[model samples]
Target chain A: MAYTKRIDGRKFNETRKMEAKVNIIKNADGSALFRFGDTIAIAAVYGPKPLHPQHLRNPEKGLLRCNYDMISFSVSERKRPGPTRRSQEISKVSEWALTPIVELEKYPNTVIDVHIIVLQANASTRCAGINAAALALANAGIPMKQLVSSVSVGKIDKKVVVDLIKEEEDYREGEGSTDIPLAFLSKSGEISLLQLDGKIRPKELDEAIKIGREASKEVYEIQKRALKAVGEEK
Target chain B: MIAEKKIIKQKVDEEREGKKKKREIAIPGEKIVSGKEYLPGDGTVREKDDIVARRFGLADISGRLVKVIPLSGIYMPRVGNIVIGRVEDVTFNGWILDLKSPYSSFLSVSECPRYIKGDLTEYYDIGDVLACKVVSVKHKSIDLTIKDRGLGKLDKGLIIHINSNKVPRVIGREGSMIKMIKDETGCEITVGQNGVVWISGSKVEDELKAKEAVLFVANKSYIEGLTDKVKKFFEGKRGGKK
Candidate 1:
């Protein structure tokens, strides 16, 4: 295989820069803003409050809902303001990824909502949104098994790379490359989310997951640091 | 029979000793003990043969019961707990009050007073702050009563909302923290179990000082030596004022 240079010159296993901050919103119970390279996402958590509408109430456990949206100007092309099919799919997957960690049964007959807004999109906005939402939920003081973190891994220029950026994603998509988005529960070392795009052999898929998990550990460290900053008064 | 009784007594003593050593931080889904050995308590649940934590908190094992004290979370309303609420709306039967919980509490007109009952709004209009006790709670509806002594219609005071879970910290162990704040600031402070705080002082400076102290505790509740830190803060403020 010929050597192909990455757009940002990152190594195959190297991840993009990650920055996280918790408690950015005062009114919301918990809030976090996270940046992965150039992509940025903000998440706010509300509730563990009574679930509205009598029919929606679950007698035994709390309901966890997530809404993922991208602002019109977030991408190069102006996107719509409201929820799109892509956004809806992201929202559903994000909720599924987070549900395993939250102690929903502890707050029975209630609801916990996570709202994530993508301010910028390079690539892997869903993964960034997941990270932000997990931090926001933790900041809100919602009980959880542990912080959840995620990263996108893809085959770019015949090389597997962690945390792909926009150009790499586009480049890979054009060439029928494979992209895998994975989320991990740091404490339990379990995969809560895994979405694969395009086709990859079993060996490559395993390698991608292994790399994604390792990158999520770095993300988990950043999340813990952000929570610590908010938990203690400096 | 005597030997059997002695063996049972020894087992109970061992369980108590085990409980003392079992206290530690727990995360959700982490197993604390076996269900056969201990009954699941607050912040914990039984799953199969194990008792697991339901939230991030401290696991408290006492004899045959295991519970967890949550580090932080929304306030779950309970009967007989005093709470500070703001009247949000006027209903025919009662007034809807925001107790800062997920569920809004209701203060029925009947719970207000026995006599003087023309219009309930006239007695407690919208946006009126009151200190009341939770009489009962069913599902999402909570019933409150202000008929008790030192409860009802907060007229003049600064109301600050903090996380309800930290209310215990603000009150401190044996009411020591609240007592210290009141004595040092010379302000009357009432902490609602629902996380609402009312502070009233003859002087505006004193009220502000007390508010600051309460906010400080809420913000830094996770820190160790909090009592001493609060005391030092009050002392510094007094010296600066002089």
Candidate 2:
């Protein structure tokens, strides 16, 4: 199978360059802006404080609330105004990714709200958001067992690709184009969140995991540099 | 990409000045770029990715700040601080509000002069918008007032929740954005990053337009010159000049 793309002569294994800035908002306990290729996500972390009565609160551990919002102009076509059902579902999945890494037991009966705003939607933004949010939490000085880093693996033309930019994502076929997004606790080497949106053979699936793991090393470096710069600024 | 390029440039500079710069003990095969390089007296707890002295233990990579210690406690509400809230209970005495803060506040009935003596139930019912004020806080109880003309129930408007910390950004330097929102929509909009917003206007469309405008500001709070964009939106709408 052949695939056509909008990008000019970009390779299948290439990843968009990514960089992140921490403490972008001085007022937030932690904040970060991450850019991967054209995808941009800004995340902020607040609290370890009391949860409102309206929101369900866990008695044994702290509650983590995540909201993923994209501006109407984030993509080439304007997204429908207001948070869509898809956004809510993504927000829920994001919390799952961070729950294992965060030391929620340390802040019992409190809440930590993570808000991610997508400024651009070139590709793999959910993964980008997860990475940015972990940095923001660390920047805020929140206690967490380890940082969570994420990457995407997909199959194109029957060959697997490490990170799928927008053009590759668009050209991907329904059944064969497999994409698996995984979040890892860099310290524990544990998978906190995993999602698969396409079909793949059993062997192919294992290959996807290996690809994701290796790509995570790069993401982990990005997170470390971002945090190190934040520490230096302080 | 820019960040990585900069890192490379920094490394090259550091290597050129290599004065045997105190090599902290490192794990033989542990990845270097992502490892946490901690100096002595750094108090952070070690995690796996952290690169620390070998004697610190193979598994210990967390760093703790030795000097900077922050005491955690209840968050106090400050005047001019934006908050998010809900109307919990209403009374002849006042409306009890939940601000998601450690303290809850009350909005006095007298302060709401526009609320006629009729069904009080009809004008502003329970769970109405809580854009009132914190007149006082004593013994963990808060006294609230909505006496100002724009401070009542939100008839029809949009409510946005910004980072309670970024309220200042939404407000801009010297009360600019808030002032523009008022001038543009001819509607009253209240912001409480503590997460309550009250908007009221005779026209639902106008109130909604005001909400959209405010949300626009909230989304791009980081960008420069947001006031112009909001003003343009208002101009495009107000005169039917589209």
Candidate whose TM-score is highest: 1
Q: How close to the true structure is residue B164 of candidate 1, measured as C-alpha lDDT?
A: 90
**Model 2, range A118-182, lDDT digits (tens) per residue?**
99997788888999898777666565556788888887657777777776666645444666778
Clashes of 1: 0
Which of the numbered candidates is closest to the native, going by highest lDDT?
A: 1
Over B171-222, each residue of candidate 1 has an lDDT whose tens digit, in order, gives: 9999999999999988999899989999999999889999999999998887
Off by over 4 Å in 1: A1-11, A50-61, A71-83, A157-160, A172-175, A186-191, A201-203, A221-234, B1-53, B57-71
DockQ of each: 0.33, 0.04
TM-score, predicted candidate 2 vs. hidden true structure: 0.53
The residue-by-residue lDDT of candidate 2 on B1-242, one tens digit each, is: 89876775676566456663322212112232343333223213434654322111112222321122211112356654434467788676666777765445776677676746756667667877756656665544567667654455665456655545445555666878877887776777677756445566768887888777767776565455777877787887777753
